[model samples]
Target: MDYIQPFNRILLVGCNECVTVCSAGGRKEVGLLSSALQSAFLSAGKSIDIKEHTLERQCDPEYVEELVGMMDGVDAVVSMACGCGVQEVARRYKNKPVFPAVNTKFMGASERQGVWAERCQGCGNCLLGITGGICPIARCSKQLMNGPCGGSTNGKCEISKEVDCAWQLIWDRLKMLGQEERYLDIIPAKDWRTAGGGGPRKIVREDLAG
Candidate 1:
């Protein structure tokens, strides 16, 4: 917070992608945060100017380029996007001081209105095909691949009765799909490299590369 005080003008940028869907770093969230910051500054007897903008996707350079014109009088940038978008912004504008306003949580899906649940880990090797579409890596307390641990009881996770055991869900789904036999198959130790165990990972499409 002290680092931001030096800047007289801050640009609050938002993403209209995942953050918008989850109601975290969307345009609405940008406005709320901007107002809150302004109030805090005014209360402290300091004046600060904040400009708000929402990009279709802050992670894409084409969308981030829109900020070029908006950056004219901005002293710093505060991104209301996930970590990826923040890094993209930083990469595009190395001269500007860029900061993330929201913490990036796990890759997840909206379970219901106002409820988002972790669904994927972006492990590179997707196991949903064999796990009956349930991802144990993200949902399971221990991220067990082969089956449920002893902590699972009555289809509920040991962490909480409210949390459904991912393995149980996988088994039930596999049973319904007539693929219960797949559960008996042993999943080998995962290759750690694809899951970012090796430095930063990337996908380069030769056809799309310039």
Candidate 2:
């Protein structure tokens, strides 16, 4: 079956927690997107049966239990949660098809209200000492460990005026902190082996595993 089609009866599910905090997908977003999709289908003379619901968290098995009876009549589920939440829902309902409504961005701390910026790449190595604490891998366009490259001009990245060169920011911060000497230190090339085999990666905590 073409499960994600507008012609089929579908459930638009949203997470009330993580996605809400991230301002990506939430109860309000669920309603907005569902209405928009329905309106679009109606405008095109195509009928769609869509129902909306918001769970405390789609990634939890307890929360997903609520969907047991609900799935019987739906053709598909459009999850408005992070990638992990979507996978959790799919794992619980193996018979049903689950589709993601939003793209998963990154693992970073929220910088401000309605703003989440990348701060770490989980590189398994900390080199903030030599880089003045600013992460060139995450903030720089080139993800250069030893950077500012030859193209940086007036503290701005050569790629775009909107982006300040990460190395420039690092240098400025280090200067303010009276740690400019750290900027002169060389950072060796990153070890990609720790990042896994350039494919799917898995972490097994023996202590936590049964």
Candidate 3:
């Protein structure tokens, strides 16, 4: 709200991808935000024109190009998708201002109804095979690869009692699979370059491009 000043006419673009499944930036959320913003402007003695639309996937250029015609009446756009979606929209329409309405939290899973938990960090490495399917990079508070940190207590992490000790779960899973010997293996330090540490990353396949 504080960042949206100087723009009375705006468009709210929602994504029908991950955000839609998570109920964050779907068609339903777009409608709610549009109504709320309109009400807010009216209450402040100002009128706002809000247009709402949900793309199949905002991260794709084909979907983002749909907004070109809709941009005729709106001064700015409020994207309800994740950061990637917002960037794609901005890239498609360079002259218009774009803003994000939802904070992109993390790559997580729906633990239960109305509840989600982080699952993957996209760390550019897959240690799940050795770790017995538990990702220490995402679940461990310290992202420990070898074993549990000193802060792990009673099969729980020091960050919170609710948070399980990732290493403990890994060990248990390995034991169940009769592969506890793998636990003795020392994993080397991660090369963060593959994990997007070397600035923005890209993949180009000449065979697929043409």
Task: Name the top TM-score candidate.
Answer: 3
Q: Name the lDDT of candidate 1.
A: 0.92
Candidate 2 lDDT, 1-210, residue by residue in tens:
234663378988999987988877899999898999888777877888999999999888999889888999897899999998899999999988899997988877787787787877766677776777888877888888765888789999999897779989998998899987777777888887666545666689999989
Better of 2 and 3 by TM-score: 3
TM-score of each: 0.95, 0.84, 0.96
63-163: candidate 1 lDDT, tens digit per residue: 99999998879999999999999999999989999988998878888889998888888888888899999998889999888999999999999999999
Q: In model 1, how large is the Cα lDDT of residue 78?
A: 95
Candidate 3 residue-pair clash tally: 0
The pairs that clash in candidate 3 are none
Candidate 1: where are CA atoms >4 Å away? none
Ranking by TM-score: 3, 1, 2
Q: Tens-digit lDDT track for model 3 on 150-208?
A: 99899999999999999999999999999989999999998888778988888799998
Q: Give the poorly placed runs of model 3, Cα more than 4 Å off.
A: none
**Residue 19 CA error for candidate 1 (Å)?**
0.9
RMSD of each: 1.2, 2.8, 1.1
After TM-score superposition, what is the CA distance of residue 9 in candidate 3 from its true location, in Å?
Answer: 1.3
How does residue 130 of candidate 3 score in lDDT? 86
